[model samples]
Target: MPHIYAKYISKVLELPLKRDNFIVYDRFVNERAELFFVSQDGVDFALTLRRKNNRYLIKYDKATRPASTFILTKALSNLAIALECEVENSNLALVQKKESEVSPWLLKPNFFEKNPTFLDGKQAELEVGFGSGRHLSAIAQEFKEKIFFGIEIYKPAALQLLGRIERENMPNIFVVDFDARLFLQTLPSDSLDKIHIHFPVPWNDSPHRRVFVKKFIDEAFRVLKPNGTLELRSDDEVYFKDACGLILEYKTSNFHVFKNRQILVSSKYEDRWKKQGKDIYDLIITAVKKQNDDKIECNFDFENAMDISIAEQICSLPAIVFDGIVVRFEDAFKSESGAFIIKIILGSVDMPESKYIYTRDGISSFYPTKPLPIRDNMIAFKKLKEKLYGKSN
Candidate 1:
């Protein structure tokens, strides 16, 4: 025997009852209806109602199971109904919440052109992740002739800067909603006059694998003109040193280093970080393309020839390697200053390919050192001899 519970039957069911009440009237009962009830003493009973001619006939019967079965079934059925109602209500609320939360920075291009007086043909420059737009706004004002493009992903910050741009009627500035690295790939090569990336997210977990690694630098170098400048600013000293090392490895002639603490155009985040007493570092580097016939000369000894080969391969992969050492026929030659200076030319294999002599040191203190000529074909022979009978005897 099981416990019994009372049940009610309604003609029309309002699935979710109103806030305060949970009862139905007798008049609401309809034909061919059944109501089941169970008692706490483990008795089960059911009442069936049907229309005969004009009046309704009510028949009662006992359940084959027990009163406990009726009570458990009734509780489970009610729980199912409540859970369904809750799920539906929650889904509706979530949809409404999402609908109401629209970004304020969403705007059309025509919105920017509403006041067309600000459009000028200035040198176009772009800065990614312009947090508060303080540095961008300052640069826009300072270089009125240059069009400044800024991209930011943060909605509130973007909205704030959009309001400022509209209020000031700064026509030379354009804002894009995107990441800086992705936005850079879309621009035409050599189209930009300058690009400034100040205090960007330094993905510092791996020093060798920064956002501004060899690939990023190579892309920046490609997009820039023959002498366009790429400025990088950061507060991390370790990151700055790693960046300097990468730049040296790339071996560009037009490079300049700067101090972030000394620079006045500090970002809002930078200011906050400064308040925390973190020393900031900045490096400004420019990339210049080599001329068609420009020669790169360096000094190299046979002992360190492999290192020189790796460096050359890294700097310019398509370059041809030459073998031999440079020897001066005479100790000193006449100079334009009426002084006797050392005259030296590299003597190596006279192949048909264009050649550059590389040496480790210079003839005197002031003269530039030359690169030793070591042909690529001779590398295998050198390796074989070393393997057979140690280093060169």
Candidate 2:
């Protein structure tokens, strides 16, 4: 959300040039704003500079932002420097200094790079939503041979745990800033030794957003090795019961429930909960047998450029929903270079992916890349393709 206010912006600026830490690759313009495809620290996204209250406000295009705000802030500051425009009420000064320390254990979501194998078939354990480094760090130190993957959606918590990993020199621990529900889908069947969900958000009001949905539990069971366990620890009894209900929906019911059970490590919240006399709940599901590695085969390829009128028509309709998947064309931007960038949100109802697609002369592909090759995503992709460019040949 870092932004700067400038008095004026040049209308005739071009791209494909290096500017400090940012590389301006392309520019797009519409009545609403002017957007530039920029890259910094190997992260590609769009930056927008638009008129507001007789002044210009520049910021990241929300649909294409990277996971780390620090990186975005740095890029924005460097961009301001490149623009050579005076700004007001900006953190541009703070990020102008030397770059902050980055951890070696942090990872971006690169699941689709030639079908790269995460952990390379090694015996691994996963901790979803590792708020602090306490549980994951402790387990990693205890089991040096087994790799530990920690998934967190919050940037600050992930950064903090990454710092702890670096400080403690725990090379076995890797942290990813992503949604655990989607991340689980990327893992291979029977690849993980254990999966842990500790202190997950209850999401009572938004049950669809809960991590223990039927599909997530199905994925967890799929990824667990034979005799492997998927454990859930929570201070909220409602969430615990909800998870139990969902797990029972599966074919196998090799699971157990515990109350006020002790673990290897206790988080500060757990300690406080115990002091307040709250009954902690635990649900452990055991993988009774190995699951088949049913890999989903699909691709996001466009053979022809879509007509402008068709694109506009599709964008005007409500979201297309089918078989637990939803595809929606959110917005469309026509670049100055006669290209179109269509912003889209599509995937499973519980875990959707948002990205931009660049369409121009002899060019039609996802902006950064395609969505993760999960079953739900694949279904959504095919459905979206049919809607846009007709049934595949």
Candidate 3:
């Protein structure tokens, strides 16, 4: 039912909606404008429009803060109106903005079979949700040889990262314009060496619980090598703690927790959080693939006894007891007679009478009702047992 708005950007803004073949939308507090398109979902979005100088730019609001997806859509609509009027008719000189330089490898897959490389001579690292390419670019600069792949669904962020890659001339980095979770799922097991998730959108509401949870960690673990590191940083305390708990429960390794050293990376969100004096928590968890010995085996014998005892207790009640109660517990024979022989016995009688009326360790049929509709009483008894215990088959 819930869909991301960025996916439908091209179809929403037709020719009739575009003025001067350009549309503008706000990205935070930026007055920058870009060619725009509205998606089929009626969400106004900006695209990279190429000018004479081969420079691309997007226009949007400069002061809007990053909120939910709905807030983003509203800001785009506001930017589109301003872009239409500013570039209405005048043919102005195309001045190239330094940020307009696009990366050749942006939105393309960088890792390949022929050019296999290792991170620190051991593993490869992958990152998701590279916002402004600041942290990613820094990491690319530090670890030049590691296979670093990034995925961003938002066009403006993707374009910004592309420009940053070209500007920095970082060859080790590759970016994709798709959902990173889906991309990670396609990778073979033990393919990645490490994974870095820096401040992903924390879906705090209950309905959005599916967005950020153990599933992502499970996928990360599945793709990482036998013993790989998963480093995650977040200013949201609740999210950080929740993630830590999940890692402890699911990941089989020793976890190390630390406080972020107030390092101002390229992320605007992180910068804002730092300025607001928010405490950032960093959880670095090293997970190893659990061996067969680590698995816990459960005993079902106690559970089976508990089920029968519960049923017997319920059938002993006055409302449930009509004439008497019959309980059948079965165990299969290993001999030529392969059928299971169930011990059926009647309850609520004297010792000798109870033993005489019921079979000791075999199938015993008895009427628990006085009326001709004997099937109804049997159905009721079965239903009562099922509700109290569980399904037998």
Candidate-wise lDDT, in order:
0.47, 0.80, 0.47
By lDDT, the best candidate is 2
Tens-digit lDDT string for candidate 1 (1-393): 212122322333343232222221111122244332222222222333344444333333232122223333333233324323221111111222221022233322223324333323335787877889999999888888787878777755676777787689777777766445445544545656777878777767855435577656765776566677788888877778888888888654567776644665778888898899887776777866534422223223334322223323333222223343222222222222222222223232221111222222332221222221223213423332253236732
- lDDT per residue for candidate 3 within 1-393, as digits (tens), equals 011122112233333343343333211111222323233233333332223333323333121112123334333434434444233221122222323233446542223322334332544677778887778788778878676777777867876777677777887777776556545544556778878788877776652433346656766777778778787888988888888777668535667888865444547778888889888888877756634322222111112322323333443454433344343331211111211211123222111011111111233222111111122223333533464456622
lDDT agreement of model 2 with the native: 0.80
Better of 1 and 2 by lDDT: 2
Looking at model 2, residue 274 earns an lDDT score of 93
TM-score on alpha carbons, each prediction: 0.44, 0.92, 0.45
The alpha-carbon deviation from the true structure for residue 269 of candidate 2, after best TM-score superposition, in angstroms, is 1.2
| Model 2: colliding residue pairs | none
Model 1 CA lDDT for position 1: 20
Global lDDT for candidate 1?
Answer: 0.47
Root mean square deviation (Cα) for candidate 2: 2.3
Please report the TM-score between candidate 1 and the true structure: 0.44
Local error of candidate 2 at 276, Å? 1.9
